[model samples]
Target: MNDFGSLLSQPVAQLGASIFTLGHVLAVTLIGLALVIAIPVMAMRRAARAQAQIAEEAASRARLAEERMAEIMRAQAEMQGRIGTIAEVFGSRQAELTKALSERLDGMTSRLGHSITEQTKSTHENLAKLQERLAVIDTAQNNIQSLAGQVVQLQHILSNKQTRGAFGQSRMEAIVADGLPHGAYEFQATLSNGNRPDCLVRMPNGAPDLVIDAKFPLESFNAIRAAAEEGGPEAQKIAAQAFRRDIEVHIKAIADKYLITGETQETAFMFVPSESIFAEIHENFEALVQRAHRARIVIVSPSLLMLSIQVIQAVLKDARMREQAHLIQGEVSRLMEDVGRLDERVRKLQGHFLQANRDIDLILTSSEKVTRRGAKIEALELGEPAPTAPESRATATDTAAHGRLRLHVVEDGE
Candidate 1:
């Protein structure tokens, strides 16, 4: 404290180190003047530029912020809408579930009657409806059982030889089930010569197709069946060889009937539905198939028929793919034409935008000219309006519309 007082008592210590000598003081004063005037002048200009940049950045950020806020509000609104929608769905589901219990569901559906009878209350009010539903269930159960019995009866009928022929007809359906859509395949088709082949396999070439005829020689088969019904082995050996002879004769009969000129191909097909019959022929009488082959008659099994169907399917697919390839080439050409038209439209649109910008610039220049005139008027006194004329003004709203419709009036000089 004593040292501070001594230091404080001196004028040079209190103020600074001393103004010192006159030349030293003058040099320090000059440096201070340079810092105060020149440095501040340069800094002030830089600060003004920085302030302007800050204002522009603030304006840009404000615009971006507004856009983000708008997007957020829209998202919030959409979310609220979705929440309302979900609430409605849940309310409806709850209402339905509640009604499912409270509502007396009576005879709404005959199909649902059984479930209702089992689940409903046993009260007197529900008893009549329940009894009605029970009656319906009884009737339906009986009908179903009867229908099942009928189905069994039908199956037994099909086990007979006459009904077995009908089985082969629906087996034709298995061939139709091949991917060869209905257009390519024909069934029970008649030949050109008044002969109806059982089924015809149309060739890839639309001419001279092969014919397949189903000939179930069931008479001999019936004889065999009868022999089995009676007992077995007693009579079939003599009649079995006779049955095999009948099969060979049937093959020859088909060749004789259908192998006419312009009617059937020399090499024709005889369709056999049962593989057991096929196996029996080849196992016992191996020469029969070979003899049929010698007659230019092929005995085709169901497996062979399905294979034929697949071959037709391949043909149909090939035809379709080839057609699609041609169509793709046509579509490519049409797409290129569309692209060219789109480019032309884009060029025209650019020209229109450029002309519109020029028109806007004309309006801006007219505005600047009016501002200059306004500034000139502000410098003059209000009493000096008598010496000066009013400044010219033009605005888009004030422009006179010159558009007029032309009408030609024909006058007759009578």
Candidate 2:
């Protein structure tokens, strides 16, 4: 602090000097002028430096802006490329989806069309079958109606005793004719006891004939049925008793007329034409059945009579077959002998064929030897000069005969 004060006092003391030289004044003025000029020059230089710094800064800012713009433009270009790629991918996917949708639609259409066609065909076939079945049902309905009418007519015919008996006789005759051969059965045949039966079946092997009586007592049975339907219990009882008596009388009459010891079967069949009447007798008239059975009389319906005829026919057929069995056996024996002779001839023929095969094998061996000799002669003629010898000059036929002789000699050696 004292040194700074002394320096300021020196400048003040110099200024306060009384004696003033011209050189001192001139030096002071020059120094003041130099300071003034130097001050202005420094200020100008500083201003110029400031202006240059501002210009460099402005240039740097301009370059940075340009680089930022370039970067932005590059980014924009990359974005555009990515956007293009995305658009292309979207377009390709759309095309694939469209193609897949189209193929699916086509497949679905084909399947639906096929399914509809098959369903239509099946429906048509079902309709056709239904129509055929309806036609058949209609025909069956018509047949049933006709059968009902026939049953009504049959009932009317059987209502009368005479017609019912005639029906039974006719049915018995028809069955007899159908089941028995032409000469085997006789209708209304006369027996030795001066009694005429409805039908008689002759037996084979001198066996007794079978009598089938067609007359059946249906009057009392009809009365019983009518009384029961009328709700008259007493009348039903009386009619049932009369029916029993009528059945017994008819059974006894058949036994007396048909049961001949030397002529007819021990048991005779009494034919009941109506199936209902036959069922009634068996169901309600057990005592009568037992009595008839005791008398050696077999009661039969139309169906049973037919079955009995068939049985008789079968018996006759069996008897005839028994009579012919010996002839069949003799013929079969002769056929067997012929077969044995044929087998022996076949064996002889097979042996002859085997001998022929052996002979053919020997002929083949001889032919092979002849072929080999010819081949040797051919090779000698091709590769060597011919010898001037008589054997070599021999005719072709002589050479062939000589080869044959050599083949025969070879076979003899073997």
Candidate 3:
């Protein structure tokens, strides 16, 4: 230990006396080489690590991209399936809408055709009715023209006194014939006093027959009217006086001739064929009318005389009904007795029908029992208990009867 310490302190090595060995030199050289190699190796190793890291990162990114692509492909498949379903739905809907539209259009077209046909028919019917109405109106117009010509001819006939009297008599006869039955009235029949009346209505109940005279004082009334229209009071007054005198004389003549106490009615009718003349006499010569009434003469227009004839007919009808009252009552009583006999016979027949129905019910019950016994016997021969027989059905009957006779048939089933 002393020697080693003296050698390190000897400074064999004082300044310029430093000692060098092979081992020391080699040691220093190895150290330097080691430093140089280690530095480069370390740097290469760092670069390799960095490159490995980059490669790892790239691999991760590729995996993520593949995953995203798989996801996108799956989504595309799903979207395609959804789109196909939507298209199918839309197609079916479109077809349905088209068919519905077509059907609706057809129905509307049919309806339009029917409406047009009906409208055309209605229009034709209306046209036909209008034509018929026009024809009717034309016929009415022709009738009016014919009536005017007849009125002119009537005026010519009425210009003569004899023709006017005949016209009045004809009018009165027509009225009497239209209103009364045959033989109830007589035309131009001479009375016991030798006065021939225009018409005589025979009253019932032994009453005197009514007399109707046709002659009237129309000439004097026509003169008065003409004079008045000529515009002079004196002419009108003179004409009116003459008309009064003529009517009074005619009334007296009719009363004397026609009024037979036992043969004619108490009051006699003076028939005036013209209602206009009747109205004029009443309006302008009321005093003459009163005088005629006092003389048992009733002045009548055609319409008034027709009404009187109708009254006479009604009276005759009432008298005939009165005369037949007892016969009608006897017929009614006989009819009632016959109805009573029919009712008694109907009741007796109904009783017979009830007894027959009861007897039929008994016979049907006996037949059903017999059929059941036969079924039992058949089962006994077969050596087995009889199966239950089917239930009997209700009977049906059709019957027709008149008075005491009847026809009927009954049917039954199981």
Candidate 4:
């Protein structure tokens, strides 16, 4: 501190005489004071201006922010109004959509219900038809079973010779009865030679009766079939020979018994009821058929016998028509005579009618003349002047002439 004061004392002593005048001292003090005051005032003014500028910027920002806030509020209010309107519209549209969907659903449900009902009814009808068809199939199955049993019975009947002969006889008789009229054929009729044939068909025109024999030799044919099936040529040949012999003998018996000279036909029928046996005979035994033909014994199947019966029926019908021809002609002649008598009666009636017509015409003329005279009498009025002598005479003469005309008409009518 002493060193610092000494340093200052030295400077003060050195300039004390020149530098320490009262005016210099006063000026230095005043300059120091002015610098101190001016620095603070300038700093205060700059701070105030900076604060005012900051306040202005803050006020401007606040105003801008308030405007932006007001705009935001208006936008929000407008958006809310638009949103409310959109909400109302959406609510109405949603209600309409719901109502439309309900209507569509109701309609769809009703249609679906009707369709289901119809489908159910159709399915039921189809089921009923299927049931009816199944019932028909069941009935057919039952019929087929019955037919199978009948076939077995037929096989049993065909096994025995006597039964087989009766079957053939029955079949032949059935064909005859179905084709020919009653009394045209007789079963088991005894011929003049004391031989009873199986059937006797009365031929037309007083011709001899046709004979049909029904017995067939089936045993030998069965044996031939069995031997053939057994696979031995020699056995089949033997069986075939036996069959041919049996057939020949049967044909000879039928020819001898049925072919009567004056009573029966020259050719006799040998009825074979089974078409298969007949076919087998014709196909495999041609010689036997030829032999039977030579013996005047025509071997006929059931179909051929039926055809023969039909021919005989035609012949009988023709003969009956021929027999009744004279009677028919007589009836026709009597009818024509009756028609001629009726024609003569009609001509007489027509003459009577013409006379009546002429009488009616005369009566009509008389009535017309009377009507004209009445009209003339009526025309002579009481108020007018009476007729003179000449007119009166003329009227009297006209009346007399009408009276004569009426008399002539009456006479003609009578």
Best by lDDT: 4
**Per-residue error at 409 for model 2, in Å?**
55
Error of 4 at 151 (Å): 29
Ranking of candidates on lDDT, top first: 4, 2, 3, 1
Report the lDDT tens digits of candidate 3 across residue range 265-316: 8899998888788888899889988998899999988667756775676687
| Cα-based lDDT for every prediction | 0.58, 0.68, 0.67, 0.70
**Per-residue lDDT over 250-288 for candidate 1, one digit per residue giving the tens place of the 0 to 100 score:** 888878767776545668877777767667777877788
- Would you list the clashing residue pairs of candidate 3? none
Error of 1 at 293 (Å): 2.2
Candidate 2: stretches off by over 4 Å: 1-166, 334-414
Candidate 1 regions off by >4 Å? 1-166, 177-180, 205-207, 225-234, 259-266, 332-414
For candidate 4, the lDDT comes to: 0.70
Question: How far does residue 106 in candidate 2 sit from its true spot (Å)?
Answer: 97
Model 4, position 335: C-alpha lDDT score: 51
RMSD in Å for all candidates = 34.1, 39.3, 33.9, 48.5
lDDT of 4 by residue, 127-242 (tens): 56556545655655564454445445434433434433334778888778756767889999998778898899999888999999987877887898899898599999999899
Error of 2 at 146 (Å): 34
Q: Is candidate 1 or candidate 2 better by lDDT?
A: 2
Candidate 1 deviation (Cα RMSD): 34.1
Estimated TM-score for each candidate: 0.38, 0.41, 0.42, 0.45
Task: Give the Cα error of residue 207 in candidate 3, in Å.
Answer: 1.9
Residue pairs that clash (backbone atoms under 3 angstroms), model 2:
none
